[model samples]
Target: MIKLELIVQVHQLKKQGFKVAAIARKCNLSRTTVYEYLEMDFEEACRWVNELRTREKKLDPYKNQILSWLKEHPDLSASQVSDWLEERCSFTNVGDSTVRSYVRELRELYHIPKTISFRSYEALEELPKGKQTQVDFGEKKVRTTKNKWKKLYVIAFVLSHSRYKYAEWQEHPFTTRDVIRSHENAFEYFGGVTEEIVYDQDKLMIVSENGGDIIYTEEFQAYKQQRGFSVYLCRAADPESKGKIENVVKFIKNNFAKNRVFHQIESWNEQCLAWLDRKGNYQVHNTIKKRPIEVFTLEKLHLREVSYPLSFESNHGSSITRTVHKDNIIKYKSNRYSVPLGTYKPHGDNTVYIRIEQEKLIIQKTPEGVTVATHPLSTGVGQLIKNSDHTRDKSKGIKAYMDTVKESFDNSEEIELFLQEIHKRYPRYIRDQLQIIQRSLRDYGPFVEQALDTCINQRLWSANDLHDVSIHLAKLSEKEIPAVLRDIPLTEASSELIKEKASVRELDGYLRILGGA
Candidate 1:
């Protein structure tokens, strides 16, 4: 038989228009059990529970021993009684449920209540106004007006001193950008920001807590840097460290969201804001014994003025995050687009933000919002839309290659200007261009100085042009070019060209060629 309290809750939820399945979910009961409970009235349920309570139990023979044990230890639980029976009683073939039922009946009949030990808490001194704010996230599954359930996510902020509260609700889980947006809204709602904010180690904002050296997510890091606020991340699994926001999260769920009909997320938020003004903030706090709104008046004076206006609808447009796959691709609308090859990492975050604008998909790196790739929005399903430049091997050290090429030529400034032009014109093929210049330095030797002058003066930014110019200069000086130099393929480009190859001619031959030139 279901307990009288559970039966009452089922009837209450049913009256609230909760379906049988929803009621079962809420009460942690099976659907069949809820159906049976709903079929019975409250009077019948009480009678049924009373009849079942008097029924004989498997452990009835040990009633005296069980009562003695309970008299000795008022704090012993049903599970503990079951364990004691298994250890002390021989051939006591009683299941845990039998012992649990018997123990409950005994406790009710004998007036022996289960003793609970409560932890003692000493209240810490209240923080000064504007010193800190605690922030946390909560989610609740609220029943929509249609009787369907929808889960809504919330990020709540509470001033550590004034206990003033601010909250925002969204139908979807928050992204890093969404968290930043909520922070802006909370700051605006509170009239200003606190000097420091406390947070749990939520992955939406924090990447890792590397032995107390906290690393925040990309966009959140940039936001914190821009907002100029200190962050204190509570130790994992320790909710008491930031109890103010924890209470605020629970309050939002129970007092505001519980049994509230969610028609739409926007209206729900509007209702929540109004509720805060009328009830949440205006009511006298139980602990502080002052209205939160009234306390906020003094706290507001101490708060730092908002550094900027709210930009919830900025030109940048809202974005959603997608994880970059091992193939350097992100899925959007059932299609895939590629980021740069090196964008994926095995251990760290591979997430990127995607924003749609003007019929195009803009894929950007996190935090910085730098565009990594862009493609026309695909209307077809399962299509792979990719930028060919993203396929390039970007892991090679382009800076080291540039440095090697620059040091080869005597006119470093001139070579630097030429390489910069190549980078601008052929960023995708920069490694190839640098490799060509390095090869020319090896084959043509000092003649490359004249080639650099030719390429820079004539605006010949192509590596092919540099190679050809160097060949022409080598010929002009009556130096015999090595057979390997003659055989080098100019038009064909490959990554193999970047690898260092042994010189074909001996040291004396290169010296003789340079001496002749």
Candidate 2:
């Protein structure tokens, strides 16, 4: 048996960069146990170590002998063994419970009996007044407006002390908003709230749980904080912990709802409430020998009255408020979904509430909460869904538009090669320079060819080089240059003129070719 200190040291040595074997050596524990404690988080390991103290069981002494006896005589019953023990052995103080417990353990270890066996149960102790309430939701098949069967939901709240109950029915499922409204209605019906409410791992509330830690849904967590009530969720596969509301649900269905037709949710609830007042609350004298409503009056002093209406809305609603991104799209689940043109105003306090339902994403403007756009939900992640009428799409920035305009120019090939060279050399200036090039093409027209050709001859990659060339092109677009400027000396004009390789041909060679060759 390992001491509790070894488990703590195993975790400590692992945190200090020790290998598994080294930690095992340091803690004097087997590598398997060390690995197990390591796999557990620090808090889990601490809890497991703290629970190591052994408390003796009453049947611990005879557990092994009972197993051997059951192995030899597989048909022996626990009650028969109890009678034999009292008559034969000196265990006269041993009651049937101790013998039965030992027999149960032996049967499990040896598998000597059938699959089913006797089980023990204890009745739940009733809680004090205003102490606890159990809540649960149930579904029933109902004939709907479409003249077909559909499932309607019922939420039941039952006080554990008095067995008094409150219930509401709805035509469809309960959204988080509907859950809050139902809670408000239930509290209003009881005229007060209990200190704690028990539930059965409801999805509207609990997302997941690990051991003692609970991860609640965002909306439910907010509701818990706002309502100022303690929450208790039954463990997985343990419905009996929240059995009160379960019984209320069954009672509501069996007695009031089974053979009855559900006309509509409102009328059914009105009729159901009247029935609860008359039959359910007024005549409940079974366990306590007093009416549930009469006992509920005594519990009311301990219960807290609803001081204000709860306004805590859950984010789990199909609709949620989200800030529009710079690209005029709202992001949900790592995907950028689109909206209509002008739906998002830059730097304005505008936001939109997005609702996803039935493969459709609805974008509604906030404050007014009007529907602005709708699109089919995309199947991929990190994608941009666009509407055709949307304006100023930042996803396709100005550079893509500039690419299209550049394709229309006659000198586009030379311009592309030049721009690629510029971009590779000075990537940071590409956007500014691309804008300048596009303006030259659009405003200066065919003269950009002259600018690009001049840039090619000068071996210059600067946009300034193109800028100077574009200025000259723009001047020439007005009219031809004056002759005085055009007829400069060769040396001076050669500096500014298009650079062509010089070629010399002798006149003597030409004359010989004409006559005496």
Question: Stretches of candidate 2 above 4 Å error?
Answer: 1-114, 117-119, 283-290, 311-517
For every model in order, what is the number of clashing pairs? Answer: 1, 0
What's each prediction's TM-score? 0.58, 0.46
Task: Estimate, for each residue in 1-517, the C-alpha lDDT of model 1 and write its tens digit.
Answer: 5489899999999999999988887899999999999999978998998987777767778899999999999999998888888788863577877778789879989999999997678889989999999999999999999987778889999998999999999875676667888888888898888999999998778878977999887778888988889999999888889988888899989999998998997799999999999988998999999999999999999998886854543743445777788899988767889888889876465667777889999888853567888899999989999998787766467887888788877888998898889998998789888888888888997888888888888989888899999999878777555765878766545546756587787788887978963
Candidate 2 TM-score, true structure as reference: 0.46
Clashing pairs in 2: none
Q: Supply candidate 2's per-residue lDDT for 515.
A: 92
lDDT of 2 by residue, 188-293 (tens): 8898899999988866677677887988767678888888899898998888788677778998888877647667777989998998899777876477788889
Q: What value of lDDT does candidate 1 attain over all alpha carbons?
A: 0.85
